[model samples]
Target: MKITDDMIDYISELARLRLKDEEKESARNEMEKIINYMDTLNQLDTTGIEAMSHAFPMKNVFRKDEVRPSADRDDILLNAPDKKNGAFKVPKTFE
Candidate 1:
């Protein structure tokens, strides 16, 4: 389906976008081309092809979780702009 100027205007309004005339024209043509491509894809026959989550082979690539010694509290708190009781002290917003 070809995207019309009216469709572009409606889409822009719906999306709260302020597209220029040139931008609107460009978007309209791109959208029409995408719709045409989808229409073409609809003509393809995929009776036996199984739908897979990924296009390529994939495997779990996770590292084993392990406990490690962390830096001392003093070392971490040294960089704080305003710290109190080994924690950052920001100004309270509420009364």
Candidate 2:
């Protein structure tokens, strides 16, 4: 696909980008190169190749979810700047 000046203008408008007269040509050339590279890649044969989400295998690194003791509610409420009825009080956010 060829990148034209009109296409660049449309893309710039959609992206809310302000491309100068001098920069339009440069942007067009760069976009053309990217599209050409994608086209070249599409021409490659990938029969029997399995689809992968990443180049390397992925594993969960998070710790196991185990039940643990927590601090007292009175101890946590002591840190609050404003507390009423054992709960933190804040200004109303919505009318």
Candidate 3:
């Protein structure tokens, strides 16, 4: 696809970019090159190849969950410098 100056102007406006006269020409050239590369890729034959989100295979690595006893609240709070009503007291994060 041909990248025109009008196309560049429309794209810059949508992107909230302020391109100078010289920069507009540079952008047009770079955008044309990118489009040409994508067009070239469209010519490749891969009828049976499966599409993938990533280049490598992916799988969850989590271990099996198991029930376990938890630490006592009193024993866990022994190291806290300040606490309130059986809970750690921290500085207010929001007004």
Candidate 4:
């Protein structure tokens, strides 16, 4: 698709960008190049290839969950500036 001045203006407005007269042409060229690259990529044949979210496989780094003894409640509460009913009391976020 051809990138026009109207498209550039609309995109800049949507993105909250204030492009100068010279910058508009630069932005339009960059956008056109990106669209052309995407079109080139779409021409590739991938009949049986499975779509993947990542280029390489990802593994969870989290340790296994295990039940364990915790510190004494009174001891933990002793350091609190303001706590009530065995829980940390914080200021109201909203009225």
**Candidate 4 CA-lDDT value:** 0.91
User: What lDDT tens digits, residue by residue, belong to model 4 across residues 1-95?
Assistant: 78999999998899999899999999899999899878887688989999899888998789779988999999999999999999899999899
Candidate number with the higher TM-score (1 or 3): 3
Error of 2 at 74 (Å): 27
Off by over 4 Å in 2: 13-16, 64-95
Tens-place lDDT digits, model 2, residues 20-88: 998999999999999888898778899999999988999968987999889988999998999999899
What order do candidates take by lDDT, descending? Answer: 3, 2, 4, 1
Q: What is the lDDT of candidate 1?
A: 0.90
Query: Which candidate leads in TM-score?
Result: 3
User: Model 4 reaches what TM-score against the true structure?
Assistant: 0.46
* lDDT tens digits by residue: candidate 1, 24-67: 88999999998888898768898999989998899989987999
Clashing pairs in 3: none
For model 4, the superposed segments whose C-alpha errors exceed 4 Å read: 46-51, 54-95
lDDT of 3 by residue, 1-95 (tens): 89999999999999999899999999999999998888987789989998998788888689769988799999999999999999999999899
Each model's number of backbone clashes? Answer: 0, 0, 0, 0
Worst 10 residues of 3 by lDDT: 60-69
TM-scores of the models, in the given order?
0.44, 0.46, 0.47, 0.46
Could you tell me how far off, in angstroms, the CA of residue 60 lies in candidate 2 after the best superposition?
3.2
Where does candidate 3 stray beyond 4 Å?
47-50, 56-95
